[model samples]
Target: MLNIALFGPPGAGKGTQSKMLIEKYNLAYISTGDILRGEIAEGTELGLQAKDIIKRGGLVPDEIIVQIMEERIQTDTEVNGFLFDGFPRTTVQAYILEGLLLKMNTKLDCMLSLEVPTDQLRNRLLDRAKKENRSDDTEEVISVRLKEYDTKTAPVANFYKEKEIYHGIDGLGGIDQIFERLTSVVDQTLQKSWINLVLLGPPGSGKGTQGRKLAEQFNLEYISTGHLMRQEIKKDTEMGQSAKTYMEKGDIVPDEIAIRLIERQIRKHPDANGFIFKGFPRTIVQAYILDGLLRKLGSVVTSSINLDVSTLESIKRLTYRGKTEGKRLYDDTDIIIHRLEQFEKRSIKVSNYYSKQDKFEIVNGLGSEEDVFKRLTDVVNKSFKKIR
Candidate 1:
């Protein structure tokens, strides 16, 4: 599949529409703005110069921008076609981008331009400005901004049109309409895009049930770590023996050994974001090690959801699940009581571990799975709130 270049104005909802297209179709979002910033940080000669100009809230020079673009596209793995959200506003940048793609033997598949009316743009910008409390957004600045965009960007639209690679979608419709059109165009253009997102939850807390629902809804791969552990115990590998040692003694496996076991499983499924760590990392020490392992692999838990189920409620759910499953992992009442005691003592200090670092959520895990899910969804939405 070829990479996509999404072109649209400031208030045209390019980000909102692009997110729908990406999630629905599985697209890698490649923003030149992100590349430009990263380039400057590496002090790659060109980045050093752009750093000064951009630090003052001014635009970087065109050559430096294109140079940054050239480096980024060459290195990116196309797990899905890229959606270029903020890029190629000028014809020169577009021309330079074509050369870079040609050198890599890749071509931009489609250029999607969001078309919104001038009046709507004005209202949207003003309302956003007021809500955001931006001092620079006056009627005068907004008017000038629109005019400058027209002068600089209209040429790039015409250029893509001449190449017959541009598709225009209405940006003023109801969100669903805009999103539906965006998805249709992207599916028609690319061969691959979606990815598996797994959520790890403990017994009776609803990870398995809700994860299945989310996977089916998004068409993603689903794998449970607890299931994996059970399978390994069934087979009895070296690490499995290590885990079995603790389980047989009614003790949680220590972090150092448990992490290596988790790492082996992780190496097998590199494409999936990660194994949903349902029961691992129950302590601050484990979370610390997991952080290093994830960093080495170049990703992090997209979010860590703490289902804040009351001690009594958690015990009830766990007890019922253990009895029904009859698996050793769930079958121990003494262990469950011990774990909950550990949870309460560490509650205060645990927040400091995640408060400033991890994408953590403390969802009220007090009620039914359905009730907890409503809250879980809210945390998921907030954590990825910017995805749309």
Candidate 2:
């Protein structure tokens, strides 16, 4: 996903542009005003504190600002990415946000600074006050807000510039004109096609959620060894019985047998928009075999997505899945913990193996299913784009 941050002084058109871009791109729209009001209405403790501060015209604390943003980032909804209308106002806030995104294995893709002259801004505020009947836009108050903006926000824009992802949009024009400038940047990004998408994370991090979203959105199909096996067992097929027998033995099924099952399923279906593989090639050797199979079939594992979760969390999620899905055979806590230990080591090798090939796009499974899935979608877009 291409995560875009819109940073500028109040009345510099971030709000106007954010709405337009969000609608056009199907991205999440986040503004300070919106978040603060939502939190206050929800009556979260943080919201209550922010409400009190806003009631007195006091600047909300940095910690509170981060707290709200942290929650917003947790939603992995259907977004091309996200638009941050007001955030990271200070250099310190920028660093804090960077750390938060880094944990999710996402980073600042681009930052836009809308530059408008002080005189025009003042006039805009005065006009807004009369038209909207907003009491906060008096001459003295508007001047104070502008000054606070200068002191608190300008440096963060400079920080993004240093990172070389900052783009300045002219805010002097009318809203249509400014929005056109922003859309040009986004259009260029989308015109670049993506060929391969690698989803990376641990179990229960919603790798599947994201994979399915991409498949649906981009007209792709997804493959999962586990899902395939279950369908076979559901049909009471011979191969399903054979596989189930080996699984019950607490032994890894032979690669030839597993691969043959997969090939037969693919031949039977024979049609897909694109394909995402899940829960196969658990080891390095399996990776080689799968790659060989895809090659023979006139394709390859274009991307390998690994869902990351803590060992403890993976166990909980797997056990939960087992209980809910009647797959209790693998739900034993001791078995899961044991598998997790091996997974920790083997997954690293799997990830590094791809990283060495520069095909890995690691994502954070730290948030709710919605949040991580959103991030995963963007990564899929970016990966296919990089190669295509």
Candidate 3:
């Protein structure tokens, strides 16, 4: 569900955008002022009390507003999600709303703030008053309302900002342009909400093919240790030279050296939505080192997906691949089997480590490419939903 708060001062076109969003995302619109007006028009008991307060020039109590929201939410159970507008006016109200949503077993996905200049807001309000014949929108009242919003409502933005879900949209553009920007932010936020995953498989298990495809489909960074090492070797960095020496000697690269290279790659793409880790963390030690590095960056591996393929199938695929590419490593059946054995021995401990955390999934690797991809995608989607 894509729940959001549409926030802005008066005359910021939130109403216009909210309608569009409701249509596009199938969200239930919750506007306090509209609800209050409807209740008054129907002459409900709560509305009578609110009308009396308005007649006496007194603001309605927060408790009454909260009660109204409780009733509304209880009755609106068919929405895909919600678009909240004009209710949380203070930090206190924001907290109350969050608590209410938590009790309801849902939460706000983000707060979308439409940023418009004060001068433009004032002009828009005055123009609205003339067209809509709203007496409360007079310049004097607008000034007082804007001042009140600055004092009371503006801090709600900070409340969401501290929660790391505040998205500010430039509200000084054409309707379509502003909507496009909002859509982009929403899409990016949804993509970034997914958990990072590591793809684990023996040689010829199709990890490279699936990892790259998943990265492109989900807008994730594809981190292939082999690719990174080859690039470093090409560049001839100190670490690359060390790894090259090991490769030339037909020896495995040291864990510490591999960890450093992987760490550098992660830091280089600090703002990536997340990453599809391919062909790294082949051992328990490397897995622990990777965890430490990710922890330093405020993240952790969310899952390790292992492709389960039979030894015979792996051998057949690698031999064919070697013939096509003229690669000596894959051409030797004995060497390929040895590599697979080593991978299985080391990867069993690593798999157990993640399995203890309930983050290990073994996907079948014997099928057509599209069939295998669909199975992988289903697992990934479920993981993404669980993380959110």
Candidate 2's residue-wise lDDT over 1-388, tens digit each? 5567887776787777888887877678877778999999999999999999989999898889888888887774445567777776678878987777644434556788888998888998899899999987799999999999888776887898787778887887778988888888666644432233445555555666677777777776666676777677679788778777756544456687679776876676555544666666777887777666654553544566666667667767887887785564555767666656656667777777666554676666777767877777777766655323
What is the Å distance of residue 187 in model 2 from its true position?
Answer: 3.7
Best-to-worst lDDT order: 3, 2, 1
RMSD in Å for candidate 1, one decimal?
13.1
Over 216-325, each residue of candidate 3 has an lDDT whose tens digit, in order, gives: 88778898877777777889898788887765443457987877777777778767888899978888888887777765564667678999999889899988887775
Question: What is candidate 3's TM-score against the reference?
Answer: 0.52
lDDT winner, 1 or 2? 2
lDDT of each: 0.66, 0.71, 0.81
- The TM-scores, one per candidate, come to 0.46, 0.53, 0.52
Model 1, 1-388: lDDT tens digits are 3367887777998888777777664567778777777777788888888988888998888877777776665565534446777567788878877777545434576798888898899999999999999879998899998888888878888998897778998887898988878767766654322221324333455666676655554444455545556666889877677777776554667676667667777777655533455565556676667666765553344556666555677678777877675546635788877766665665445455555433456766666667766776677655443222
82, model 3: CA deviation in Å?
0.8
Q: Regarding TM-score, does 2 or 3 come out ahead?
A: 2
